[model samples]
Every structure is written in structure tokens, then in C-alpha cells.
Target: MKRSVVVRLLAAGATAATAAAIGLTLQVPQAAAAVGGVTGYATQNGGTTGGAGGQTVQASTGTAIHAALCNRASSSTPIIIQVSGTINHGNTAKVSGSSCNTADGVIELKEISNVTILGVGSGAIFDQVGIHIRDSSNIIIQNVTVRNVKKSGSPTSNGGDAIGMESTVRRVWVDHVTLEASGGESEGYDGLFDMKNDVEYVTLSYSILRNSGRGGLIGSSETDTGSGYITFHHNLYTNIDSRTPLLRGGIAHIYNNHYVSLNESGINSRAGARAKVENNYFKNSKDVLGTFYTDAAGYWQASGNILDNVTWSSPGSDTNPAGPSMPSNTTVSIPYSYSLDAASCVPNVVAATAGANKGLQVSNGSCTPVSPTAGPSASPTRTAGPSPSASPTRSPSTSPTASPNPPSGTNLSLASGAGADGSSKADGTSYGNVRDGSLSTYWSPSGATGDISVKWGSNVTVARAVIREPSGTSGSIGSWQLINYDTGAVLKSGSGAGTITFTATSLKKITFRITSSSGAPKVAEFETYAS
Candidate 1:
């Protein structure tokens, strides 16, 4: 529904034409040069060293990206495919109704190895098009913004992710990218990143995954455990409800990432997955850590993590915060040496480093990164979820001190949904947009006349509230009152779309009553945080 969601979008159910399995054949012209020259991108994991070397090729569209991927002279020769401009819905998986009946979607990197897809020039964007990596290895992707990747309306392919892989994918380094979405199942969007079917030896760094239901998943199903040795570091996961990451089985290193405003579950490790969780910043979220939502549990060796402005739900006996109760036999030592950023600096460090347009400005978090002379030598372990944050050049011992992040008190309005707005869009938007933690969607009053409010199950001590304006609108609220619904107290009043700072000591309900407006007002977010 919004930017970059279609990257991993998939609806329920499917047919032969609709199953998006890996290994779909790509039809490429016979004449294009197979050698590719790709450059000006970040180096990769899996022992890839130095700059992107090989033949350089340029592509301007989704078909062109696929062509570039398929144009490799041989599987062993590294080719660089520089993609610039927009890769839209053209030449992607075929769509029928809301579902894609074809197997391949957008750019399909199938049966190709030693490839680098670099976003060059002004940058590369995958809009409503999913990039499927199937049976491929030794790849690198950088400086790309994949937005509105519609999950297949039908389960046409396993690559219903912004950047996804299936069946024997290995050694992929995805860096400095932006993956986005609208909302979750209710909004018809899927995971920002999804990997499955024997996928291994992948690293995602300095990336941003935003506004979606699922962050990503490793291993296909509860019974699928062939995946392992994945590294997630220095990323930003924000404005999503859950699945900061869901790991099934593997040895994963999750460190130095920022997670903000998580609504439901976060860092779901299950089915024998093992994650070494270190030095991550978890803020304004719930269930920010641990195994959840399944009978089979996962494992984590967690340290140097900051849980600030966070809450947790009672997810039955399976959720283990200290780490999964799995035996030590399944654990694997983290392969690379890393430094943890003080949790206090995550929000700022990530803000400065974690996106495609950042020109690869990585924070010297709290440690200097030293690459091993060779690739990781360990046998294999398993893991998944949002990463952490740290200095790239120094350790926390040498970093400057900022105020420590505040821990989140209980969220009294967790169960609250959006209220009625007279001018709300009927096409697809809902009043719930205000609280969905999405930047692509928003709530608009049908008229200048209605009130927007939320009621909590019990009274909450609210210290701050932020009412974010929408993406593009000229209308503004001329007058509004922040009212305490349970006690009928006007906590504060405002006349514009900005931070609504007030102190509600304890209240069961709170509302923004719009008494007057210049036009039908729209709000991208109406959030309340407790400290």
C-alpha cells in the first residue's frame, strides 16, 4: 500500500501459476555481454574484499535489472550491474486481480553467482517490484531504496519480500539500503526482508526496514532448519508493529541496531534458531526481545542491549527474555569481533548512518571494525531480527556520554484503536492509520469537525505525545484540545501540527478534540510515549 512494501508482499493461498517458488527461469536475450562491471558500492561478507571488480553494466528498469543479473558470462565471474532510476512494475511477476499469477517478480537473480547489484548515480528504487534471489550466491547489493514492494497478492513466489532469497542462497551482503512498507496483514503488506530454504552466509548492514508487520524471517517453516551463519548489524528498524525479525534456525549475529515504536512482538526466535544479541538499541516498543508466538523455542546469548521505552506482552510460557531455554549444545560462538555502541547513542547514530541516501555515512559506533583475513571459519549457527548500533571507529569506553535512554513504562493505550474522522479516506485508509506506526499511511478527518481519541484499558501516566502531520497536506488544525476521556480534563490545547507536550498523571483515556480547522486535517501519526 505504501513505499517498498511490495518488496515482500504476498497474499494468502495460491495455484501453480501463483506459487512464487525459487528457481524460476529467466528469459534473457542471447546477445548482451555476460561480463559486468559494477563499482562504487560497499564490500561484502563471505571473504569478498576490495572494491567491486568485474565488467560494469548499466540498467534503468526492472527488466533491465533482471537482464543485468542474468547477463553474467559465467557463474564464477563477478559482474557488477549498476542500476539507476526507478524499477517499477514493468516486466515483473504477472499480476491478476490483486495477486501475481507468475512466478518471477520484478528482478529475479536466479541461478546466477558472483554478482553485484549496485545502485549508482542518483540511486536505484524498486517500486512495487520484488527482487527475488534464488539459487544464487556471492552477491552484493548497495545504495538502493526498495519501497512499496507488494507482497504477492497471491503466493506466486517465495520472494514476496523487498529483497528475498530461497533455496541455497549464500554469501550476500546487502548494505546501505532502504526497505519500506505500509502496514501489516490488514493492509496487505508483508515482510521487508525474507530468506528461506537453505539460505546462509548473508550479511545486512547499515540498512533501514520500516513500517511493516513482519521484518523478515529465516528458514521456511518450523521443520526447515538448514539455514545458518547470517549476520545483521548496524541497521534501523522503525514504525512497525512486530517482527523486528523472526528467526527460525541458524547461527545469527545481531548487533548495533536501532528499533523504535514496535507495537506487537519483536525479535522472534523459534525452531532452534540461535542469535548472539549484542549492543542493540530497543526503544518505544514491546516484546523487543526473546522467543515468542510458537511452541518450539529459539536461543540467544544477549549482552550489552539497551531496553528503553519498551513494553512486553505476556506471550504465554514460550517467551523467554533471558534467552531461549534451549540447551547449550545448539549454541554457536559469534565469529566476528565487534564493539557495542552504548544503547544511549543508537537513536542518533542510526539516524545518521542507516539509509540508502546517506552516502554510506556509517557511524564509528563504539568499535573499529577489523575484518578477518579470511571469511568466517565456523561451521554454522542460526539467528534473525533487527540489528544493533555501535561506533565504527571506537568502543564505548572511548565514546562520549549522552543521557541514557529511559525505560518505557506500561502502555495504557495499547489496545486502543483509531476513532472516527468525518473526512477519512474511504479508498483504503482508516482512522487506525494514526497509530499504525507507518510513514506511508495516515489518518485524515473527513471534515474539519470530528475528534480523534483513544481509550486505554486502564489509567496510564503519559509524559509525552507527538502528533505528526501527514506527508503532503495544506490543511491545519486551527484549534484542538488534548482531553482526558476518563476524567474529562483538558490536559492541553494546540493550534498547529507539532509536538503536543502535556502531563497526564494517570488517565484511562486521552483524545485530541479538534474544535476548529482551516481544512480537513490529516495526521500521519498520533503517538503517546510513557517514561
Candidate 2:
């Protein structure tokens, strides 16, 4: 049978009884079956290939899912468990084996690796049964629906997360699943999808997270800064109160997602978290991006996003909204390659391709839904350059230079006659702070990019400059230019804050121009050297 025909039959709710009556037994897909390829950051760290050449088994109950894991030949053995029917607490029990660790009431994927749990044959639904993963790697969960798992209610599972991962988890790709809740913490529900405790290199793609108080979070606390390198794309977030994943001290790529009716703050980036948000559509949301409910600020680099009827609240000591006019405050460099559907088509594309029971369909990056067999092509319909409606461009320097160690010389920036100035400064920050020689005090641009210069009463021959960032906030400065302000000539240009050597230029003034950044660039010290 053609793959498209099978997909159509499955999408039309074909039943096993009907297939049996028609003298056709439903066969599980083989190891090479194309459910969809891994995208985003999950493609890093040796890549997330889950059970590609492993034995495929059928599972209807949660216990069977546990048994499938326990029955594996070894803890690292690859296996794909095809789940169907409704999985609930009554049918779930603790299963023991040398290879698996499981508990009652939840689908626990613990201390195991190279596993894939996929929905097949009339669909798989985990009703009030959450999926928990811990201390594992290279796992994939796809085409399943988990709803109403609570943290504080009766028969709670997985700490109220529809899916939760922790304790050094890595390389998990969750795709085409529905994770939802009926209400907020008052109703005993918690996050839909969450990760913490050194979790890294994960991706949540083409999924639905809706009708919940909290969508998800990267780190569990403000100080839990170890987890990072996540991607959320082509997902639908609707009727969520907050956290659309509160990020803390990690780098996240959020793109091509559809957000609607966010009751409160969304994408709460805090505790030094940095996000690259692009090509998404937001409608009827409030405070869609910012740091909220915490004094510790987060940062974002936004572009190619369409915000329709979004509202922003007044900035407070603890609330900082990025909307009203969302601008890119940073520039994040993504390692992997992926295509993007236009922001205008994100709503339509996400609605058609996201969520379970959609035949595992995916986009061809031009708003066209294609069969999973076609897979994701590399033909990018859109480039990473800013959109037409994007914020005004900040031109970077033309000449690129290599970063080197700080030159051994006198610090010219701290001279008695030296003075500092900038194009603009953020609140509570002064341009003079960059030469103050204290890492505790720093200077930030009014927005993402600006210039700060150190001027001398007399001309001085400078050979190098060292750009130092504040502690705990490294890697904020992106593209920058070292210019002789007296001559308007760029002496050196590069990305990142470090020492750069240049020909000795005798000038009265020199400027360090930040043209791009991953977050608010905090220049603790911009030291000029005369070697």
C-alpha cells in the first residue's frame, strides 16, 4: 500500500476491528519508517537518533510500555514501543528489571537510553498519566497525547508534568504530541512539558501545549542554571497563563510556533536566560516576551515574528515586557541548519502540521504540508536575515579580526585624563562603568547595540583592546567593532568579547561599537592597551 494511503486511513480513524474485518492486519512500521527527522538543537551532541534499528513492539497499557523497557536485552539496547489505546493509572504498575526502573501510575523512562515510544494504530492517549524521563539520553516520544496530569491532585503522576525530564537528561526529541491540562495549580495541574537538573540538547517540535497555567520551564529554580540548549518550534501554545516555558540560564531557540490567548506573561526569560525567537505568530497574548515576577532579568533576540492584538503591561520592578514593540536585544548563533516557514504562514502551517493524530505530517518550509516520507528538505524558503518588518539594522564593521590574548602593556583606558561616553546607556548603567575596573559595575546599551568610547586629552598609540564581560554573564557581546574615533576608521572587527590586536594607531579617541549581541551586552571593562 502507498504510504499516503496508509496515512490517510490512519488519520481517518481506522480501527483494528475494521481492518481485521477487511482481512487486513495493521502492521507496525519498520525501523526505517519515516516519522520525521530530528530538527533544532536536538541534532547536536552526536544527534538524537532513537531506536532507529531496534525491535518494534506493540503496547496498549502503561504496564506494557514499562514491560517493553524492562524486557530490553540491556539498559542501552535500542527499542521502539508502539503505543495505542488509553493509558491510565489503573492499568499501570511498577515493573522491575535489570535494565529498567519504573513506578506505578506513571510511564517512567528512567535510567534507560536509545528508546522511542510512538503512537500507532487508532492513536495513543495517556489520560492523567504523565511521562517522566530521568538520567537517560537519546530518547524520542512522538504522536501521543497526555492530558490532565496533576502534581497535587488525587492519582497525580510525574510531578504534574505531562512530560518531565531531569537529572542529566540529554538529546530528547518530543514531536507531534499533545500535552495539556484542564486548569492551573488551583485545580492540581502543573507544567505540560518541563526539563531541569542538567538537561541539555532537547527539542519540542510540532506539538500542542494548551489550556494550562504553566506551559513549561527549563530550570527548576533561579539558581538551577545547568540545563540548556533547547529548541521549541512549530508548536501551538493556547490558553496558557504563563511560562510558555520560563527559561533560566540556558540558550533556547523558539521559532515558528503559534501562540494564542496567553492570559499572562509568556516566554518568561529570567535568571540570565537567553532566547532566540523568530518567525512565530502571537495573537491575543499579553506580555508575550520578557522577565516577569523576578528581579533577575533574562534576554531575547527576536525577529520575523508577528504579534497580533498583543498587549503589554507597564514595566515594574519585577515585570519587564518586551512587546509594544519587540526588538532584537541579542543575536544567537545556531549551530544546526533548518528552514523556516514565513511568519505570515506560521499559523496555517502550525495548525496543519502540529499536534497528534495528524498522520505525522510536516511542512516543506513554504507553508505546504507534505507526507512524512518526504522528510524535511534543506531548501530554505527564507534566510536567517531579518524580515522586511524587522527592526532597523545596526551596521557592523566590515573588517574582521582574530581574537588574541590581551597584550602586555599599560591600561590606557584607566588613565587620569581618560573619559568615557556612549551613544546610549541602559537605566542604572553608565558609560564610565566600562572603564571603572570593577566587574561588579557594568555598562549596557539602551537597546541591543550601541557605541561606548574612551577618549584621552592627548593622542596615545594603542596596539590592542580587551573587552571583558561581567561575571556570570559571559557571551553576551556579539559582533563588535574597534574603531579609531578620531579618524572614523575601524581598526578591528569581530564577534564576541575578547582581546584583539591591531596596528598601533595614535588617536585621541577610540570607540568600541557593539553591533549585535546574544543578550544585553554587559561590558564590565573595555581596556585599551599601549604595547
Best by lDDT: 2
lDDT (10s digit) by residue, model 2, range 1-531:
234424533554754443333322223446823357898878765467787777776778887777667756566667787888899998888767767899999999887778888888889999999999998878999999999999996989999999999996878999999999999999999999999998888999999999999999999999998788899999999999999989999899999999999999899999999999989999999999999999999999998899999999999999999978888777776766677888999999899999989988888887888788766753455555335345222244443333444467678999999999765567799989989888899999755766788989889999888888886777888888777754345677778877777888899888887878887888888899886
- lDDT values of the candidates? 0.60, 0.82
Model 1 lDDT vs. the true structure? 0.60
User: Candidate 1 deviates by what RMSD?
Assistant: 24.7
Compared with the true structure, what per-residue lDDT tens digits does model 1 show for residues 410-457? 433334542322212323557677776665777664445345665555
In candidate 1, where is summed lDDT lowest over 10 consecutive residues? 34-43
Q: Relative to the unseen true structure, what is the C-alpha lDDT of residue 515 in candidate 2, on a scale of 0 to 100?
A: 71
**CA displacement after TM-score superposition, residue 205 of candidate 1 (Å):** 0.5
TM-score of decoy 1: 0.57
